[model samples]
Target: MPGLLYLFTLCNLVIGTGAFVLGGVLAPMASALGVSVAAAGQAMTAYALSTAVLAPLVLVLTGRWPRARVLVVSMAVFALGNLICAMADSLPVLLAGRVLMGVGAVFTAVAAGIAVALVEPQRRGRALSLVFIGISMSYVIGLPLGAWLGFRHGWHVPVAVVAGTAALTCGALAMALPRTISAPGASFQGLGDLLRRAEVLWTLSLTLLYFVAIFCVFAYIGPVLQALLPMSTERMSVTLMLFGLSGVVGTVVGGWANDRFGPRRTLTVQLAVLAAMMLLVPLTRGNHALIVLVFVVWGIAGFGMMSPQQSRLAALAPAQAPILLSLNTSMLYIGTALGAAIGGPAALTVGFDRLAWVGVPFALAGWLTLRLGVTKGASWRPA
Candidate 1:
């Protein structure tokens, strides 16, 4: 189980690296492809859009296959997509490649499904936490490394690194997992049934709201920092690194809290704290040291939300955990896309001074919704 968990962690690292590379390489990619930086940034939108739309559909369509086989194939496809990005000479080609990466990255749901399937029920929260921590690790290791490679060589080099990693991860999964460990495949009707449940729908909505709040500020985090602190780019980079490191701790602590106190109480408290964090965003102005403290707290709240939400969904629909988890991932991406879209306008209008405050209602609303919709130990099996 430990070895298998490590493999899934690596798989998640690959997924995270691919998802984040666009942000780091947007400038170089735009320069190389002869497109505007904003145009190059559209590749991120394309990836998020495709991931949101395709993840569940692809799971249903391929649900019948052996899970390990599906994972291998997905990773292969992801590698292929990154390879395309590495060689792309035009914006359209890059967009197409990003779409492919989105399709392939849905395999992350497979990784989570495998984690839950292999672990004991009591330890499921811990297992899910390990799976999610990989994303934070990407920020800690993969994203920075890729960004550095892009700065040193070219944008293509960073993507090429991801392509290589995906290929290796695919190979590792094939060698590590046994053939007997797979769920029965799903039909479109199966997915439809899962979606019709009130709990599932509402739970997914909460997940969406959580990310929308975070990304609304996160999308404009750079300018927000600049407005408040007026620091050098190096200091800004270091601040972000510290935030990412704290997030790694948050993921672990979130899982432990869920296991100890139950998801409902843990998540409610976390969300409430998250709302408080947003409320503090406006206070960081001109206080560089204070801003650092605030960001650390923000990172803790930011990545901490995943474990409880994931544990909730897995508990609600164990049989459909893979499909449900895939949908959760989609909702998160949709929130990210919407948050970025909303952030642009909010930054322009309210300015970053109050931009952090803009996301406060979202966090509060999510907390309120969770309080109403999810009860302590209140999980319902899919009919």
Candidate 2:
């Protein structure tokens, strides 16, 4: 079981790297595809949107399959998508490849769901959290490394590397897992039942807006940072690595705060901090120290919300945690889609330096909705 869990973790690392690598490599990808940076950025939106729609659908459809089969097949699709992307010569081709990757992106949610069912109930939470380590590590290693490689060798290099990794992960998962391991099939209808509750919708909105806030600036971070303070490729990679490191720190802080103060207060503070950091981006002009400081804090606050948001959903409807968690994942990707969709145009119009500011309204909107949710069912502390 432990070995299986580790495989899932490695699986997520491959998936997360593929999902986020574009953020760091967007500029080069744009040049390679002969599109503006913003257009190249839409590949992110395409990937996210495809995942948003396909994740739940794929999960439910494949619910009856062996976990190992599902994992291997989905990962194979992801690998194929990356290969398509690596060879893409036009924006449409890149977008098509991204959509294919999104189809395979369902692996994360399915893995999470099965992780819940497969583990002994007592250790489920710990096991689930363990699976998520790959996600943060993706940021720490994948994003920056892809950025560095893409910059040096052109965008295709990183995509090709990721494709290779995904292929390897597929084989590893197939070898590591039980042939007959199966969990209850999911129901998209069941997901709809959760959404019927007003509180669930409202709470889910917070997840959407929060991610919308995070990804808007994040999707274009490479260009945004470059516009502010130009740096060599090596320096940019280091800067991105620092940002990723800070996110890991923030995830820890979020867990601590949730334990002591509860998810609500922890998130409230995090959201406010994130919003302020977004606004602070433009003001960091001519100030290297300030930009560095803001990006670090922003990384902390932005990533910190994950722990609480999941906790908040669990607390909202205890019996519904599993599905709510899955649904929240859907909302998250949807938000990612929206953010990337919005960020590109906003970056073009508002200018890259002001890109962070575009996300400010989203953060505050989430903050206010969260506050309002408390009046109905959202609580300050988990009861």
Candidate 3:
């Protein structure tokens, strides 16, 4: 199970780097493409919107296919999309490529479903979080590397590298992922039916708000880090690495907390910490050492929320777990899209140094929605 889970982790690592490398490479991408920094950020918005809108359609169309087949094909599509992005000479071409990459979001959703399905119910939380560790690890490895390469050589270098790895991951997933395992896939009507439920709707709202809260800053983190976290060039390198390492630690601890304390309790604490950090991060400007501590804790709380949120939604509708997870992924991306879309312009008005303020309302709304609107148990309101 651990080995198989790590395979899924590697799969996510590639997919995640492809998705997140934009942040590190944003400046050069903007310079090369002849767009504003905010405009360049829309490439992320394009990718997120594509994932938010289309991955579900892919899920519905390929619902009955083998999970292994879906995983393989999705990585292939992801590789193709990034290759297009690397070759793009203009913004329209870039947008089209990102839209294609949107097809890749299914990989993560399906991976999560498989992770939970393969494990004992008691251990699903840990298994699920472990699957996402690759994404956190990307911040440690992929983002920094992508940024450095983009800065020195060209933005296309890192994007082309992402394409190569994704192609390799396709072969690895094809060989490693079991063809015999066929978990339930989501249908269009099945997804619509789940959305009609009040509790499910509210739970998905929680997901949307949670991500909007984080990505407001995260979407522009490279710039925001430069503005807000006052540190020397050497310390800045260490700070970003620490942020990634803490994410791995947070992911591990989040799973344990979910199993030990339940998703609701764990999320309450995580959300509160996340909200506090967003506000606190801006205030720690002059004190570099203190800022690093806050940023480390922030990464822990930020990445830690994923497992618990997925657990809550799964527990909400065990029978519809795949579809629900798919929907949650959509909301997550939608939130990410909203954050990027909002952050790009808002950063101008608020200043990157003070940008965490944008996420505060979202954090508060997510907590309120979770506590007040979502049901404690899996009781769905009648159709």
Candidate 4:
């Protein structure tokens, strides 16, 4: 079980790192491929869009397959996508590679969540959190490593590394995970019925809004740090590490809170904290010490939202756990794309200092949505 969890997490780390490390390499990629930074940005957007569109579809189509087989296949596809990315020299080919990668990532994410849930009902929160740690580690280690590699060896090196990681993850999953099928009646109609529930809609809405708010500020974090701190490359890397470390801590805290307090209340508190931290970000510019403090708080508040939100979604849609979780993941990537699209223009017009201010209302909106759902008799019990 531990081995399965580690492999699953590693899959997430590679996919996430591969998808996001492009942000750091945008200038170099644009120069090499003879495209504008805007075009390279669009390629990233394409990746998210592909993930969002494919996640539910893949989950529904593969609903009957042995979970372990599904996971192995997904990782294999992910490896191939990265291989494509590593070899591609043209803009169109790169975009194609990203699309393939996104599809593989979407499937792996959904399948992993379902596999974790199957491990132990009581330990669901911990299991899911452990898988998501891959994502947090990607933020903490993979992205920084990718950036460093991109700076030293060019953009292709990181993509190649991600491909290698994906291959290793595939092997691990094949060897470790047991073959398991979904319970009877876990079909597409079950997923449709879950989607029709108001509580499920509310939970997903909260997921979407929270991600929008967090990613809005996060999408421009590098640029914001550059503009505000004006740090040497070494110091900037250190700052990134600090932010990632904080995320790991936050994930553990959120998992603990979810298990102790239940998902709804924990998520509500985390979202509120996130809103408060966003509001504080504008005040911390140019003060390196204060900036680090704010980032740690932001990491705690932002990454903290994930476990509770996911646990809530799974509990709410018990009959269609895999599909619902897959949809939630899709919403998350969509939220990332939306936030990036909105924030880029906002940053261009209002500057990075004001980006946090722009995200505050979105966080407040998420809190309100979750709060309203709770008031309307959405039970906290696991589905």
Candidate 5:
């Protein structure tokens, strides 16, 4: 179980790395593929939309398989997707690879479900916290390193690294994870029953809205920064690393808060702070120090919500935990696609100067959703 935990974390790290790799390599990928930067950005949208659309299909198909076997196959596919990405010579081929990677992302929820299954109920939050640190570390180490490599070598080098890493983690998971079948009655069909609950739907809606707000601003952060100040790729990488480092702290604290207090209160605070950060971004335009400071707070408040949200969904529907979690991931990427889609056009129209203005409403709406719909005046213990 411990081995599965570690190996799954590594796989998630690879997923996290792949998620943002294209953002960093946008210019180079665009140049190489003979497409515009906007076209390259579409690869991100393709990856996200594909994940959103394919989640149910993948879950339904793998419903009866041993989770370990499912994980192994998924990781192999993920590696193959990255390999295709590394070797692609045309825009269409690259987008296809992105779609393949999105399909393989089903394993992320599977891994989270497996981790939760292995731990006691009371410890699930802590266990998930440990697992999610891989995501934060990807921001801190994986993203910057990929960007640095992309800047020096080629865009393909970073993706090739992801392929190699995924392959290694696939081997580790195949050996480490037990070849045990899922508990009886844990079927994908149960997802429909769970979603019928108001609380469940509201929780998922909050997840979607939160990411939409976040990615709206996040998708164009590079352009926003470049517009505000002349910065090198190395400088941008380092700045983003600091933001990621803050996220690591936030993830740990958010998990502890969820288990120690409760997800409702924790998430309320996180989302409120996130909304404030979004509002403040427009004011910090010219001052690099202020912008960086806002980003640091944004990192904490933004990424912090994830662990609590996951814990909340699990608590709300433990019977449907796996499917619900998978659905939550689907919602997450759906929001990502929505954000990029909206953000790109809004940025183009209103300019990057006012991008965060559009994001603020979504953040506040997320907080309101939790407060009014999910929590309903519930009290939680303080840490």
Candidate 6:
């Protein structure tokens, strides 16, 4: 079980790293391939879209398979996808690789979450957060490492590293994870039935809106920092590291808060903090130190929303744990895609300094949806 946890974490690390590393390499990749930066950036959108479209469908289709076999196969697919990415010289091939990786990423997350729940229901919140720490670590360490490699050697180096990691994770899972079948009666119909509930719809809506706000600001963060602060590139990297570190702390804190105070209160407080921070971001211009401080706050508030929101979704349809969790993952990626799509155009129109303002309404909307869910008694209380 410990080995399985480590394998799951490693798989998530590779997937999360691969998913966002392209952002740092977009300009170089575009120039090397003789394409616009916008075209290169589409690789991220493609990956997110594929994840959103495939997560629930794939999980439902393969829900009855042995857990260890499913995990190994998923990691293998991810390894192949990263290998393809490392070898690709054209934008289309790159996008194809990203799409393949997206499917594997979603599958890994769904299977891992189900596994965690099965391991211990009482500790599900902490278990899920531990699995998600891979994502937080990617931002904290993986992206910076990828950026350094891409800048010094070439964009392909980082992709090769991710591919290697994926292969290693596959081997670890195959050797360590226990073979287990799905719970009796767990099927696509269970997922379909869960989705019919109003509470489930509300939870998903909140998930979508919160991600839209978080990703919109995050997607354009580079330009926003450049425009607002007079920091050197190295300084900007350090600031991003601070944000990532704070995000790791925030995820842990959110999980603790969820277990202690319940998901409703934790989510509400986090959303409110996020909205306030976004609104104050523009005011932090002209002071690099202040910008860093604001980023720490933003990271704490923004990332703190993730665990509680996911926990809320899990509680929404407890019977269809795998499918509900998978759909929540899909909503997150869809929100990310939507945020980037809308934020890019908004930045072009209003400038990056105002991008923070653009996220305010979405954050408010997320808060409102969450409040509605709470009012409707969708929140779970431990007895």
Candidate 2, residue 258: Cα displacement in angstroms equals: 3.2
Q: How high is each candidate's TM-score?
A: 0.89, 0.92, 0.95, 0.92, 0.93, 0.92
Q: Model 5 — TM-score against the truth?
A: 0.93
TM-score of 6: 0.92
Question: For candidate 6, lDDT tens digit of each residue in 211-253?
Answer: 8887776765556777687555466667777877888888788
Question: Which residue ranges in model 5 land beyond 4 Å of their true spot?
Answer: 1-3, 181-186, 375-383
Evaluated with TM-score, which candidate comes out highest?
A: 3
Error of 5 at 357 (Å): 2.2
The Cα error of candidate 2 at residue 366, in Å, is 0.6
C-alpha lDDT (0 to 100) for residue 164 of candidate 4: 91
Give a tens-digit lDDT track for model 3, residues 260-345: 98877888898899999888988977777777788788889889988988887787677678878888899999999999999999
Which pairs of residues collide in candidate 4?
Answer: none
lDDT digits (tens) for residues 130-192 of candidate 4: 788778877788877776777678889988999998898888778877766443212467666
lDDT of 1 at 378: 41
Q: Which candidate ranks first by lDDT, i.e. highest? A: 3
Residue 52, candidate 6: Cα error in Å is: 0.8
Distance from true location, Cα of 17 in model 4, Å: 1.5
lDDT of 6 at 215: 74
Q: What are the lDDT scores of the predictions, listed in order? A: 0.78, 0.81, 0.84, 0.76, 0.80, 0.75
Model 1, span 1-383: residue lDDT tens: 45677777788888888887666555566788897644555676677778899866888788788887888888898899899988988989888998999899878888888788888777888898898888877766766566567756888888988899899988888888788774545455567777776777778888889888887776555557777877553566566667778788888988888888887788878888788888897887888888888878888877887988888888886777877788899999888777766776777688876788888888887887676665432455211
Query: Candidate 6 — worst ten consecutive residues by lDDT sum?
Result: 181-190
